[model samples]
Target: MSKTPSLARRTKSFQASPTAALDAAAKRLAAEGHTVCNLASGEPDMEPVAAIREAAAKAAMGGYSKYTQVSGTLSLRQAVSRALLRDQGLSYQPDQIVVSAGAKQALFNAFSCLLDPDDEAILPAPYWVSYPEQIKLAGGRPVIVPADAAGGYKLTPEALSQALSPKSRLLVLNSPNNPSGAVYTDSELSALVEVALDHGLTIVSDEVYQQVLYPPARHVSPASLSAAAFSATVLISGVSKTYAMTGWRIGYLASPDPDLIRAAAALQSQTSGNPTAVAQRAAEVAWDLPPEATRHQLAAFTARRRLVLDALAEVTGTELVPPNGAFYGFLSIAGCLRRWREEAADAFCERLLAEDKVAVVPGSAFGAPDAIRFSFAVADDVLKEALVRLTQALRR
Candidate 1:
């Protein structure tokens, strides 16, 4: 037999998403008649609003199902343009937008285009799991700067400044952050943007959770800081979170730098091509819907947040920095890990799932080995039961 060819060198940098892995394990157990309470999913449990669904149906029936422009349909791109202006007061023309399969792909395209081999991309700790992986796959090095509970799990300007090197070329920011739900205030972003600008860094701001915010907390786009900041940013967002349309697979990147937009679009064109045709049309309806349309979903998340908060409070030895925007609770389980005689969060999480039947993503997935992340975007009863089971398991 002939020898098998070796996999590409980049394959070494790939790791499957931890949340998806846990979800698969939970589903396998459930199929075997286990009573599993899964809180590992990051997507909303609700369906897209009626208006958005109606548009998809209309598109499918009206034969709007063909492939769109490589970038996106002009109509959808215009909707994205209007949305950016309306929400962030940052203006971007259609040519400056590249709609991709998801914000993940958009981020990947940005990294692929911006990074040369061995370039450094700054990522704050407790970040979304995919950021570092994506950067590495792009032939860039990820420089992780740890942020603690004392800093509200957010990167500070001083830390960012210290992490910079001549090799530094990109900075990734996720507001209403995943796994942490830490939203940066405008002043905070401005201070960070100032640091990034001083170093001539290209800022990739992921704002997918922009509309999933709670009151007294607001989403601020770094690009909205000023013209200089706008020019330095590659803004990534999607209708997935706000519209309960994760499967729709629609996300986009917008930048005032035409060169960056063109490069990302070209990269996307050769990869996934345009996103689904009908999803683009439906996302137009989603993007155009007034803020009032999704208020009910946000209301549900708020109620669930309270439920998770109360439930977690009863779980001894766990600490949570209450989320202000996204529908996740990142719990520090160091105390619980020590009590359970487990040295890592992943090991504790595995036992929690196997023995207790509650699923969560280990904190190690997000560069924080002593913590774990659970989504509260599930049903009220499901969340309640899962928390109860978690508390009981921790006690033992």
Candidate 2:
């Protein structure tokens, strides 16, 4: 038999996202009737807003199923621009917005459009699982800055200053971050923006969870903080988290720079070629709806956060940090290390799944070892059950 054709080097460089792996494992256990409680997935269990669904139905009935322009429909782009102006206090024209399948694709499009071979991108530790992989896929180097747990898993200006170099093309910032749920304050964001401007680095701010902050905690967008930051910032956001429209597949990128938006749109044309036309129409409504629905969700999430935190509090040696926003509790399980021969985060997660029937994504996947991420987007009873199981597993 002839040797198999060599696969592309790019294919070899890519690794499956850890969130996907943990979700798959949970599904397998549930299929085997283990009564598994999956705290692994990042998606919210709530349904999309009724207005969005109705709009989608109307769009489909009205023959809005055709492919849209590469950058998205003009109306949706206009809606996105208005949203930026209204919410973030940033201004952009329709041409400066490109709607993509999800915030993930929007980010990938930015990397593809901006990165060249050997270019460098900075990611804070405990970042979203996809950032480093995306940088590598774009033929760029990922320079990860480790954020100490002592700092409550937050990145600092000193760390950013040390990581910057001439080749630094972008710095990916996810506030109200996934996995960790650590939201940066206005001052923290401003400080980092100052560092980025000093180094001539483009800032890619992922604000997907901007509206999920708890009481006394406010989200501050880097682009909204200063004109210098806005000039170099590409703000990425979507209705997936805020409006509970994850399956709707509508997300957008807004930039003040027309050239960068155009470059991302060019790649979108050849790749996904705009998001679903109907989804885009529904998202237009989502962006325009009253704030009641989102505010309700945030309140419910905050209550759930309290429940989970209280339950986990009784367990000894488990260091759980209360998230300021986003629906995740990232626990420092380094104390649980003594229970296992191997102290690696992934190994601990595997044991918990096997022993407790509770599934969670390990923090090593986010470049932070000795921790695990517990998503609290499930129902209250489900979250309680998962926490109970986790408590039992950890105590043993």
Candidate 3:
């Protein structure tokens, strides 16, 4: 008999992300007693809110161990709906919401529920590394529009208009974006909404980092701009980034369309079944908490952002665009490679890890070839140490 064949062709697009690879490498080096500073991971090192932890413990004791509705528990959905209304000024019914494993699964479910073989999804450059892979897994083509440092790594209305085609089914927008930390202003998002309206495109707004914005920067949800935009958009967000509940595995999607929510529910039922019951209960409490707790976490992240920006400034030849929000500094390291014979971004990162014991993600992973992403979600001293090592490595 012939040997068992491998999985389907789509698996090629699902390779482990460079950030994950770097994290694993850092872990291995640490296990071997090497002093490796990992700035490659996007996860914040902070703990979940106190109320969230207490709620989780209460739920575990209260026997919330059984399966909930495939979409989500009614209480969790209602909490999510109300949170969206309060925070984003977007209203939706409980039936129009679906809770999933995380924003990642919620996004995957959105694409799977909305896209087909011939559909196209437009993604802005310097996007989250998972966007294209998720699009491919849903059998949709990803049409990338490049964004440079000059534009704050954001997609303009003109760029969106040029990239949209008749076959375009969705436009994925991540405000306070992943690598660049570029936040979209209200006017900018309104212009993009007009483009989407004119072209009849569905907007998928990934606002997972909404609460982590810097003071001068604001996060504008496309769905909150207008009733039309709300009806045609799927707003994806979760507790992971906001409440520092990365291990909780709870995320939600809000849309005004019942059919889209139903489709996502059906897809999730056959795949993930349901988000954890205890997590759902815990998330409900998180959504119902006093605003002061969340404000404290935001304050901490804001301080960390400033600390990282200052540290990066000390390193010569590094050009930082001053990330307005999020805990990342997507820096241009092209000048650091001027003396290297092999000037590729990946080669630069590999050499830095080998010589300086610092792990950072190369920009090639995020569709920007001349930059690197430094996550400032770690403690201040660790961030400083990483920068020191990076400075030494580049100078060499």
Candidate 4:
């Protein structure tokens, strides 16, 4: 081969999102006329609320299709501020918010702005797969603090303290957690926040799954616990999960520190200048339509969660961390994978899909290789079939 210029040094160690990769592979198989039951998707099978869609359509037709402000429209930012206060009591101003293409982008911007080349960020595992990858992409090292079924996959104060080093600059908290569905309690969060403050670390609170939480599992914002935490934490959220508006691509980040918010906005301005104008309008509408408003979708998701719980109960040699919230069931394959324990998790995921045509994400992708994460975000019939297929395949 002729001598060629190289790809960016920044991408030397980057990993593509396994969640997206699995979702896409399932979609490809389905498109190829295969009878695959796709439980790999993290999105609910629902449409954006009618009001949200209508608002976006009206805005687009009213010549509001032009590029928006770099941070996002002031209207959307203000709406976000109001919603945060109304929902979480996270007292943030419109100017302190920066809307991005998605919550993923907001996370990327925050990490990029905060991390130095060799700084360390604490990632409580089995975190969302993107957390570590995003940390790596920001030129920061991800120091994963692994949690297991015993702790419900949540980080304890001791774990947080042990993971800290002088180079630790940030901690990423995702709850109601993806894969694990662990919602951190206010007391738990307060302890973690205290540890973070002592370590002089910033907390990136990803609250995207907050709305999907089921009964008895409360959502607590760390930033709301104390004035210090409020100052130390950056909030990330979007309208995707709550309103089923994933394609809308409207997300925002908020922080009381103007300088940090400004820094992230500066980075976002050069990248995706703004989230879509129509999407921003739609997000504004979505912010007002609480998750309770979608009674049908909520009921369906609750039923799906219960269905998975019941199915897993019959599957011995497996343990599911009682999911307090979110639409995923993170089942430990440790007791079950008697033979596969000697092999890689990816192998089983592939073999299961190839043989049984049931798609689920390998747990290794989430920094927990002894299990798998299944999104219960599908129709009732589809979910039942998928669970049946999973049980049948695992029995082998």
Error of 1 at 235 (Å): 0.4
State residue 283's C-alpha deviation in candidate 2, in Å. 0.9
Encode model 2's per-residue lDDT on 1-396: one tens digit a residue.
899899886687779988988899999999998999999988888887788899999999999988888888999988888777787777888988889999999999988878999999999998999999988888889999988678978889999888888899899999988877888888888899998988889999999998888868888898887788889899899989999898888888888888888889888888889799899989999998767857778777989999978988877667887888899989887877756555667877888889888899888898988889988998888898998888888787
**Candidate 4: which pairs clash?**
none
Q: What does candidate 4 score on TM?
A: 0.97
lDDT of 4 by residue, 73-190 (tens): 8888989998998998778889999999999999999999999998999999998988888888888999999998988899999999999998999999998999899999888888
* Candidate with more favorable, higher TM-score: 1 or 2: 1
State the C-alpha lDDT per candidate: 0.91, 0.87, 0.87, 0.88
What is the per-residue lDDT of model 3 for residues 179-224, given as tens digits with 9 covering 90 to 100? Answer: 9999999998999999998889999999999888887898899988
Superior by TM-score: candidate 2 or candidate 3: 2
With a 3 Å backbone cut-off (N, CA, C), the pairs that clash in candidate 2 are none
Q: Name the weakest run of 10 consecutive residues (lDDT summed) in model 4.
A: 336-345
In angstroms, give how far residue 233 of model 4 lies from its true place: 0.6
- Which parts of model 3 are misplaced by more than 4 Å? 1-5, 339-343
Best by lDDT: 1
**Stretches > 4 Å off in candidate 4:** 1-6
